[model samples]
Structures are given as C-alpha cells and as structure tokens.
Target: MIAVDQHPLGRRGTVVANNAGLVVMVKELADGDRAVSLTNETGSTATISTTADALGIANRGPYRLKDPWTKVPSTNTTGTISASVPSHATVVHRTAPGPAPLPP
Candidate 1:
C-alpha cells in the first residue's frame, strides 16, 4: 500500500507491477484534500475521496474492445477495489505448466 499527503499537481505515485505484468499507479490531487486517482496498466482510472465516502472508476482500454466498466461501494461509502484486465481482453489466465505428467 502507498500513501500521499498534499501531493503536487500532475504528481503521479510510484508504479508497482505484479507477477501478471500489470502496472498500477496512484495519483494524488494537488488541489483536493486526500483525493487520489488510481490508474491501471490499461489506463483505467478510479478516483476516490479519502475524507468522504465516495469512489468512482472509469475503464479505458486499448486491450479489450468492450464497454467501459465502473463500480461504487454498496454499503460503506468508501472501500478498496482490485482490478484486472477485462475478460474480453486477451490475457493469460493459467500459470505456467509444469513438466508433463509421467504416463500412468
């Protein structure tokens, strides 16, 4: 997890890549208090208010030619979310295969 306080305009947070080769970023708003924008490798972005209980996500993609997707918290005003490539996008879902099983 990463944290920022009073970030500067156009200031983007660190980029973290998981084993799946997806790049993740957190951009803080210079004007708003504790407001941040989270962007995935596909350029999808989500803006959330740290103070208030609000969250929004906009899916932007060149990977998958599909409608954008958005999600908001149901119960709590604020919550955490994890995003991966859209199903339509071509992604490797299975892990590397081990050596072929020996004949029974």
Candidate 2:
C-alpha cells in the first residue's frame, strides 16, 4: 500500500502510475499529509485533477478517497519501477526452455 501527502495547493489530487504499475492518487486530502490514490492494473496512467476526484473513485471520508472499481490480476506480468536514472535501457536476457535430460 502507498501513502500520499496532501499538496499545498488546497489538497489537489492526481492519479499516477507507481513503480508496481498500480493506479493510485490522493482524494480529499487534508491540510497535512494523507493518502489519496490506489491503482488496479498495469500500463495505465493515474488521473490527477482538482475536480471532484475521478469518476470511479470517491471520497469515502473527510480525508480519504477510494476506487469503486474491481481489479483482475494477470499471470504473464513481472517488472519493477525505479525513479533512479539509468545510463540506458537494455534487455538483460530472454526466456528459454529448460534443459533436456541426457541419455541414460
């Protein structure tokens, strides 16, 4: 679970993709630190706005917001998110079949 702090700009909110490919954002943030977003899938952008939060998500309470949508998980997915700058992007290796047994 991720936590978000309320921005100084009157607790505005924005949906953003985290390193784990989750869609999350802060909703109805308080005057101080608070959480406001959550993601449900990969390869999707988090919607950030000053409006009445996102369509599917709603402010559950005075200092919290939640997504009313359900999420489904996938099997063929594995990756990591990083804010650190790298020299270049490269493929470390490719998938391969297991080795076959030798003759007896």
Evaluated with lDDT, which candidate comes out highest?
2
Please list the C-alpha lDDT of all candidates, in the order they appear: 0.28, 0.29
* lDDT, model 1, position 13: 48
Q: For residues 1-104, write the lDDT of model 2, one tens digit per residue.
A: 22223234464554543445443454343333333333334343433222122322223222222222221211111121112222221111111111223557
Q: Which segments of model 2 are wrong by more than 4 Å?
A: 1-10, 18-21, 42-104
Evaluate candidate 2 by giving its C-alpha RMSD to the native, one decimal. 19.6
RMSD of each: 17.5, 19.6
Q: Each candidate's TM vs. the true structure? A: 0.29, 0.22
RMSD of 1: 17.5
Residue 5, candidate 2: alpha-carbon lDDT:
32
Q: Give the TM-score of candidate 2.
A: 0.22
